[model samples]
Target: MRLSRYFLPVLKETPAEAQIVSHRYMLRAGMIKQASAGIYSWLPLGFKVLRKLENIVHEEQVRAGHIPMLMPTLQSADLWRESGRYDGYGEEMLRMQDRHGRDMLFSPTAEEMFTDVFRSHVKSYKDLPLTLYQIQWKFRDEIRPRFGVMRGREFLMKDGYNFDQSKEDALHAYNRHLVSYLRTYERMGLQAIPMRADSGPIGGDYTHEFLVLAETGESEVFYDSEITDLKFGDREIDFDSVEQCQAVLEEFTSRYARTDETHDEAVFNALPEERRRVARGIEVGQIFYFGTQYSEALGATVQTPDGTSVPVHMGSHGIGVSRLLGAIIEASHDDKGIIWPEGVTPFHCGIVNLKQGDEAADGACEALYGSLTALGLEPLYDDRNERAGGKFATMDLIGLPWRITVGPRGLKNGVVELTCRRTGESEELPPEQAVAKVAEIYAGI
Candidate 1:
């Protein structure tokens, strides 16, 4: 991707409405533009990152033995009515009438719709352990939608629903989701602590919200300090093994962690004083184990071998796909801009021609770009006829994980500078070696 041809409309002055770091940077970087009070238009760069996050979510879910499918953004109000939640869901749901005067809603959640599909087709316990998910746009008319994508009225989300024949099986599905979510967040360079949280309108007695701690986060959280050291790095997982998934669930949740919604002051105080820590966190995902909550309401029952019909146990899990970008930026950015983790960066590497239009500098950058692209890597080349400082600033603002700096002086010395965005460190090496280094770093990711 060449900067000269790209549609990145970066702003020099920060927008006044951006009250948080994520919002400020997102606006100034030209990743998003306000479409309404709480909605946004994801620009090309923003859209690219959004899609990257969506893909990661899909990969993790599928790896956990969940099936992927698409659901409509608009659904019939009849499903909600059938579940006895149409009136109970309140104003956050954007309710309206179609041309035929039928009640409709922009889907805030798909629990009811999924249950309807289940009851209509799945009649036997044979399909009991099925888990289906979709990455789709959702709307939840926030009363005061602030904070860019973090608390937007409209956003993208990965919502999954599981149906099992028994309570035990549903709980295992819940554990599976927790295991997958840990790996998913870790891959994006985030440490999202799984904290006990109130289910809210989702309605589950068992739930955990994954939170990435940041000073600017919206949720006030109390947790054990030791939880910070836990990492799910490169560990092999057997998603189909119930025992393996349950072990992971117990290991990660053994420590004390809870959000403000479910805070137990007495329990928190019982821990050693030194081990307790209180801070803010941005929620990125959640898992629930509500046995028969939606299934019972929507008549989603399956037949057992003994010829008995029973409501299937069910649970819903969600990852705020679009909101994750804000959370990542809040947790990873520095004064310069967002420092995208290699796993989720829109572009793998950036090519900067310090002396653009100079024959040697141009040739070196072009060669680097070609080599990276040929290797199935996306490298954003700052090919515009701009000053070195401006080009460098843009690279820093956009935050590709690695960058190659090509100039007449460096090229004359038979090398180019490879810089890491997170470390802000640079080393000069031959062009091929620099490309190899970047590729090596991402290959591991």
Candidate 2:
């Protein structure tokens, strides 16, 4: 992508309305624009990152054996009424009426809709232990939505529903999702600690919110530092073997961790002083094991082998896909701008033509850009006739992992300077060697 041809509308001065670092930087970087109080139109650069996140989440969920399905953004209110939550869900529900005067709503969550789908077709234990998911937009009327996409009223969410024939089966499915969530966040270069949390209106005795610690986070969280060092890759997971996944889940959950909603002060105080960590947390994902909550209320029952009918035990898992874009910046940005993780960055390399009109400089940058793209890399070439400082600042603000500079002097010497945005390190290399070096740095192998 060429800068002159790109739609990146970067701002020079920070917006006054942005209270937090991510919120301010997002505006200044022009990644998103406010469509309303809490709604936003994701610009080109922002949409690229959001789509990458959704793909990662989708891959991880599929690896955990959950099938993908698309659910509607607008759903019939009858489903919620059937589940006995129409009145109980409160103001966040976004209630409305259609032209026919029938009740409708932009679903804040899809627990009821999934239950209805299950009751309509799945009639036996044969279809038990099914897990389905969707990546879609959701609406919630936040009284005070702030901090950019971090707390937006309209946002994208990756939500999954699990149905099992018994409580034991449902627990196993829930634990599988917990393992998947940890893997997903880690792949995106985020440390997410699973902490016990309140079910809220979702209504479940068993719930866990995966939190990424940041100063601007919305929830207060307490945990053991050891949780940060733990790695899921260290363990061998046999997905077919439920016990293997169960053991991994237990190892992580055994540590002390909880959000303010479910904090047990006595238990927290008993921890060794050095291991204790109290910080603000941004919720990236949440999972719940609600046994028969939706099934019983909505008559979602299946046949048993003993010729009896039984309510299906169910659970729901959610990842705030759009919110993660802001949450990651909140945790990783520096004074210059966002320090995007390589996995989620819109492009891996920013190729700057420091002297665009100069034939030699332009030739070197164009050659390097072509080579990088051919090697399966996404490179942003600044072909605009701009000053070197402005080019550098624009690249830094967007936070591509690497910057390759082709200036008149460097081009004369048959060399280009490769800059590491995260480390602020640079070294000169021949144009032929630039692609391989950038690939190595991106892989970090």
Candidate 3:
């Protein structure tokens, strides 16, 4: 996209309301706009990143054998009542009534609604292993919604529900989700530790919250420092094999890790002092194995092979799709601005014409942009008639993973400056070489 035609309303001064790095940078970088006290309108750049995250989630989920479908933002209160949570869900739920005075709600979660769908059509054990998910908007009316998208009242989330015939099957589904989530977060350049965590209103005895450690995180966390050394690198796996999935679950969760809500001082003290670490964590996702909690409550039963009706075993998995933006920024940004990972950057590379109107400089940038675009990559060309410093500052602020600097001086030497945002390193390469390097960097991703 050309900077001159883009609708990025960057701020010269940070908003006073932004209290953290992610919030301040998001505001000053023109990623989001506050539509209300606890709500926001995602600007083009922000929306692009959000969609990228959603796509990664969808791809990983499908690879793990889960199907995707969408659900509504608003649902009937009757479903919540059927699940026995209508009154128990408390003020975070936005309860309302329609024109006919039928009670309704802006759903904070879709447990009850998903269960309703299950009971209505899925009546046999043959469909027991089905897992369905949706990426949609959700609302939870927090009394003090701060930290931009991190703790906003309205957010985007990917929530999946699994239905199974037995406890063992349900547990396997849980493990599958854990494996998929590990891949999902790693693809976004995050290391989300799966820590034993309390299941808050969801009512599950078994649950794990994936957290990215950041000083600005809200949840106080304790962990074995060795856990931080763990990485889910690129590995082949059969998602359908219970043993494989279970092995991964054990590998990632064997370390001592827990949030403040479930911290046990005695257990933590047993770990070697050198291996113990305490810090703050931003929750990016969670998985729950609740057995029959929602199914029994909502009468989502299936017929067994022996002709008996039984409540299906179930679990729910979720990724905070929008909040992930804040978590990624908190974990990856430097003092200057966000350093977006290549996998989720809005633009793959940026083209800066150090001398915008100069014929040679402009021609070089246009050529580089075309070369990158032809390779199925998007490059932001700062074609605006602006000073070199201003253009470079904007490129840094928006945080593209790669940048190509074009100038008459560089062109005369048959070279262009290619810079990496994460490392303040640059290399002088020919225009084609710069484009080829960027393409190869993202090829595996």
**Against the unseen true structure, what C-alpha lDDT does each candidate score?**
0.93, 0.90, 0.94
> Deviation in angstroms for 438 in model 2?
1.9
What candidate 2 gets wrong by more than 4 Å, as runs, is 234-236, 442-445
**Residue-level lDDT tens digits of model 2 in 1-445:** 9889999999999988999998888888889999999999999999999999999999899988999998899999888888788998989889999999999999899998888888999999997779989999999999999999999899999999999998988988988998899889987889889999999889898999999999988999999888888887634466657797788889989999999988999998999999999999999999999998789999999999998999999999999999999989998889999999898999989999888788888788889888998888889999998898999899989899888988899777888898888899999999878889888767641
Candidate topping lDDT: 3
Q: Model 1, range 256-324, lDDT digits (tens) per residue? A: 999999999999999999999999999999999888888888899999999999999999999999999
For candidate 3, what is the total of clashing residue pairs?
A: 0
What is the lDDT, from 0 to 100, of the residue 370 in candidate 3? Answer: 89
Candidate 1 local Cα displacement, residue 280, angstroms: 0.2
How big is the RMSD of model 3?
0.8
Local error of candidate 3 at 270, Å?
1.2
lDDT of 1 at 294: 84
Which residue pairs does candidate 2 place in steric collision?
none
Reference-based TM-score, model 3:
0.99
TM-score per model over all chains: 0.98, 0.98, 0.99
